[model samples]
Target: MCSLAPHPFLSLSKPFTKRTLISLRNVIRDSALNKPGILADSSASPSRDAAVLIPFCNVNDVPGILFEVRGKTLRSHSGEISFPGGRIDSTDKSFLAGALRETREELGISPNRVEVLGELGPTEVNLRGNMRVWPYVAFVHGHQINEKGTLDTPLSSIDLEDVWKHRSLEEVASVFHLPLQALASPVRLKASKFRGGWPYWAVDVSDLVEAEKVEHGDGEFVDEVGCGQEGRIEIWGLTGWYLSLLTRILQIHS
Candidate 1:
């Protein structure tokens, strides 16, 4: 039971406007409220719970989502591409607080700059522990940037480097963004399978999502994420599954 998707967002030619953002916020808020959490049953208790922010940004007027490449220095999951988040802290007031705190720590984007929209859930099982992941959807906001790279004009495109100052090399290796439109374009789709042993939709987003101030090389991303295309970021596994849920919720076929 899902309706036809991709039609509603097929013609998003123009840059993301204030009105468009408002519409998206409403949709996310409403849809999120109705969706059930992945762990509705109390049969099991995970060793750890983590919170992540699925941050959406408008780049050069186009809607896109941001991702991070983890530094190799980390103990676990090093050199991986994922969202800005980590294990929930004891001091955090709520799951949203943990997500916002992680965002600020990893991306330099403050909680005030992001409009928290909603959340999603999916758990992970590993030898270390069974973990529950809570993903909060948010819109990153910033001052206007003109061609001259000043904040004098209305909102246009935000140079992420300008906003990303606190992200450390020890924690995050690089930051990139994948355009929303590119995800739905048939030409960009690639044949692939999920780690869970089923057909999965994959998209090569090398051209649209460029890394800024990243320390790693392009070739390593393929190894880290098992991308079929060389030097390109492929949306697969959990990332693609999350995108699929969002697409279905928004009725955007991909």
Candidate 2:
């Protein structure tokens, strides 16, 4: 299990001040307003459509973002840290519903507990350049944190130890929270380049006990390739791209 610790510089005692929430809402609104125009060109006739929820929660009053480590046995994106979501199902009424449904299936979090803030726009993932991902900003309500600054013992009505014991084990290995303040901090973000000279951003997670070395698709481990804290547990690819957009919004609003 990964240790859930606040960044050294963040004071958990005072997390989401009124001003912070206001700023966050403002950012979400601005993104929603500007998304359509920004994505109109690239999003046309996308090969695939999917949605992901960027869930914000106040744990011990500290604002953090929820992420799931995909189960190793999964066929796609195994052992990767990602936002809770998946491809749109035929029965899904809307992208929002699909995102929420996937969240519930992956993390056992009820959609009622998530307060949708707004959409952050659609973006194309680098994986084969075929998938389009619509991201939604949301706040998770009623979930509490313990004195240790971790999720309350029985998260989403089940004990922490039993998180992987559920049927979601086929998709999710474990769930974890990363402090939004830490991600928004300049010191924690590093600038890098991706294939074809594309600009990329990554968060430093070297201090995290859960950070592990990433293995390539060929079953070979690359020591210094992917983006992550010190090249380990790379948060690169589409996940890194989405988080980069989030950190940018936070920086502007901060």
Candidate 3:
């Protein structure tokens, strides 16, 4: 059974207090961070495992985030958009450890190079009617990678110049709002099902969620809800929920 405890996510309406922001600054100052050896198993019923890294790099004087489109060849969550992390391995001492490990494996991110900024609460899921999931968050410094001396490398060597570009938090927020407003719109609720099943929704302007059909200018397709705006960041599913909360907190502080 799932726990009744509520998870805490970052809000966008208000910026963090000076003290809180300072705390985050302090976390980034840490001298050493450990790495997890490998990722964990995803088999069995309601098991606890999985960690994801919200990797960020400073490019052209702005923070740019790294996300992945899982290769369609994968067995689970194929071709979905997500962070560079995965399931907790037996070697992982903790959830944070697992997250860093998976990120390193998938995106060639080094655990030691990433400074932890704390984690958001976990999200639970039953994959394929089995495999329980727990998702956690961590912030990383935005810096560039040197080909020879850099701390990481691309696992797939696939081109990411288009999606992995520098985007201001404000731009990200504007894109986010386009969907939050829609979620409140009656049109969305009519399509949303009960909690017993899946949470289906989309944001046309920045439809990040996978369930919702992101309009790609080819004329809207059926069963696919147009994400109002064209070519905007699509926010949906777990990533959408996480972004929504993060934006709320950042906005509150800013």
Candidate 4:
């Protein structure tokens, strides 16, 4: 694996502080609110509106991001790794509300457990190139206050393997946590045939996790995985592009 530039979060000798979180939030907020072009193009209207949550948390006093693997049985983007979100529903109040609602539906995670920070910006996808995806940043609370107003155990204290035991099998295959430091120095790969003729950069995180075999069909198994406890996950396409932007932001601020 080729090494990229050193990540500030990993280089730091001390753990992240409230100041670090503030700076990161400021960066995302400024990028989302100030950069109008990043949000959308007024001349061309989007065919569909969607939103996603870039959920992060403090694990063992270190910063980490959460990702979900789409179920292989799903019709669209099956077995792919992505953030916990979906298209905005009619009953939703706003894009933010839709994102949080989808998170709950996807992972059984309560919307109340997430502390909304800001958005990263919007991105377009699909063959017709009409789907608009809005990415938001939020911090996950360690402990969730119960519906009856009772305090529960910290979520971070739960075992990683058991995190997805209760998730909807029809939507999510598994959930995984990746350290911010590891993502900071991801290996870069190229793909020339992604989404038709569009060229794109793919982030290779093979070194970060153990590889597992997956059965495709007809007794054939592929040594590939998703961003979870045990598997080889390939983070590419629009998601990779968004992560590229995040790495740049972190590098600049670091």
Q: Mind giving the per-residue lDDT tens digits that candidate 2 earns over 57-165?
A: 6665556777777777878788777889999889999989999999889878778777677777546554666667888887765543222223222123223343335
Best by lDDT: 1
Candidate 4 residue-wise lDDT, 1-254, digit = tens: 23355344333223334445556677777654336565333445668888889887656655677777787788878777788898897999998999999988988778877777777755655434577788888777655522132122223322355457767778887677767666654342434234554444455566644445777778998754454223435676667656655655555221
Residue 98, model 2: Cα distance from true site in angstroms: 0.6
- Give the Cα-based TM-score of candidate 4 against the true structure: 0.75
TM-score of every model versus the real structure? 0.74, 0.72, 0.50, 0.75
Candidate lDDT values, in order: 0.64, 0.62, 0.41, 0.63
TM-score of 3: 0.50
RMSD values for the candidates in order, in angstroms, are 5.8, 7.4, 11.4, 5.7
**Tens digit per residue, CA lDDT, model 1, 77-127:** 665567888888899998789989988888888787787766753433232
Ranking by TM-score: 4, 1, 2, 3
Q: Residue 102 of model 2: what lDDT?
A: 94
